[model samples]
Target: MSSTQQPQPVLNCDDLLELIPAYAFGLASPKEQQQVESGLTTCPEATAQLADYRRMQDDLRESVPQIEPPPALEDRLMAAIAAEPPARRRMPQVHRAWWAAAAAVVALVFSNVYWISRSSSAPPKAPDTNSHPILVQGDSSFVLTSSREIRWVRLPSAQKNTDATAVLMWNVESEIGLLYVRGFPPLSAGKTFQLWLTMGDAKLSAGTFQVDETGSGALLFNVTAPIDEYTWARITEEPEQGSSEPGEAVVVVGEL
Candidate 1:
């Protein structure tokens, strides 16, 4: 259709102009043409205003500027870039480390053989199962906290309101179990540490508990479903009223 040809209107120009918004909005019916004609008789100024607006819009569409991006855009971007420290000049990929590693392995093998020979030559050492509880004689115990596992060597006797260490081993049976703590930080008024078993669709609450002045307390926790379920265990600080769900930072966590 030519631009000059107005869409074949059922209403006259005077009637159509009056119904411009509704007509422009495609809402004018053939029966409403009389009412539209009556409106134009009293509102010719509105028609002129709409015409002026349409002309201004057309002019703007043709005149809007489209300029190229500034050359400094590249310079500005480059200036913002921090030159990465000479990539640490990757150490030459030679088999030198492997050779060193091979040498260490040889030394370890020789040392192990020598120790085995010495042990076979010498008599067996006496057992100390009380202080060191392990299935085997030479096996050592390591303290594993709620956070992460740590190799326990010589730990000082635990004092009240202080961290304590102990040999903790998780049996595959209890995927997540309680770490009844003692000699640790006491809970502030109206707050407690909550344990969680994040295994399934929803987090399972172990229990909301606190420590006493002696720092003796039991944190009740259930392993995730399926008995030997692999789950991430965590402890979070919660309101004294207790939380229906987890609502604090994870104070401790460990995989079981």
Candidate 2:
């Protein structure tokens, strides 16, 4: 395995990922949020992966135009729910028919909840922006002493991807940033992912990450200069130790 292999652990990482959809949607409870934040330290790449999921979800939602249901959608759905009464006694064995009916019941329940929540006309409030990210490396950690500025920039184009997605979240004051990317083809052995922060004639290595089997990767790294000082950023596949100057092809790029 490469030294850059995904960091050892992020607690119950599978469980944490399952919670990401809720976490990103702001539907997670305070306790769940805390659980993610506390364990998110073990693998900052996982946190970046979570961000990728959030962006994908938002893009999916945006692409699917909203279609209002028929006026009777609510009333008809309610009647169908009432018609199917619950089975009072536990069965020794469940059958296929029973499973089908149970699925319908679950659907009805979620439909009701969705409609109720969407009843409000007000747009959702934004997450509080006056906060900083805590970056942890092993036992030591630091809350970014950053100015109250965070930038969420989507990498608009990729040299190697026809359907890849990447997003960069950078804190200018802290000189630290996290990047998450999905859909790039896995590289040949001996290659690794590296980030580049560029100012006119100067370039600095911001961070590096190892891609998993799924060809998704992320990194949290120290930026050498303020975001405004850099005109762009990039992710490149280089030798395992990475390069001071980009050696391999750049896979993803974005404006700072």
Candidate 3:
């Protein structure tokens, strides 16, 4: 069986609980987040089942919700794309079986709604279980989560060493907040990565990004106040005419 010794897919505990929502919304795709980080570095029961799905995603981001798209879902997706039937010119080879049967019924209904929305959260808790991630009100404080794993370094004080490790999980309740990032790094040729929020010296400028090569990147910052008065968070390496301070260093830091 040496076609690269085929016989791997046995990662269960239900495939590390289905790779924990792409490992807590960091959205695994850097080769499936390095094959779920090499199956959680040799599965200590899948690393305690992905730390109970990252503590039930920090207690469901303390009750996260702000779902939209129900303005009759854009009038029922523009009334079903204006009632189909438009590729006329009468059956030119039945137009690739009518667009491959409408792309196999939209990939079998989006893979059955991604396997029923992959276990809909709620699982990990018990490490002295304590949580407090609420702040849903009128939704729109700050939320941005993105990580599909991507890191390719060349170090030596990086004049260009590649990067990716995203994190900005914040949920400050009605005062509003939620930013999430995971394993993000990928930017070559005229680099860029800047995001910072401090309170002491009041250095606020939460924006700037670059990542692709499957190390997905995202942004959604809207703060009119209350991100717990920001207490340090960083990401710098700018200079496409950007920088009021923090020239470079601290590729990833915490505390916010």
Best by TM-score: 2
**Using lDDT as the measure, which candidate wins?**
2
After TM-score superposition, the amount by which residue 48's alpha carbon in candidate 3 deviates from its true location, in angstroms, is 59
| Clash counts for all predictions | 0, 0, 16
Candidate 2 weakest lDDT stretch, 10 residues: 109-118
Model 2 scores a TM of 0.44
Which one wins by TM-score: 1 or 2?
Answer: 2
lDDT of 3 by residue, 34-121 (tens): 5565566556876786787788878988897867656778888879889984431222343335323322332232322111111326
The predicted structure with the larger lDDT, 1 or 2, is 2
Q: Estimate each model's TM-score.
A: 0.32, 0.44, 0.21
- What ranking of all candidate models by lDDT puts the best one first? 2, 3, 1
The RMSD of every model to the true structure, in order and in angstroms, is: 27.8, 24.1, 24.8
Can you tell me which runs of candidate 2 are displaced by over 4 Å?
1-133, 138-148
Error of model 3, residue 143, in angstroms: 11
- Name the runs in model 3 displaced over 4 angstroms: 1-122, 126-169, 173-186, 189-192, 202-210, 213-226, 231-236, 239-245, 248-256
Question: Each prediction's Cα lDDT score?
Answer: 0.45, 0.59, 0.48
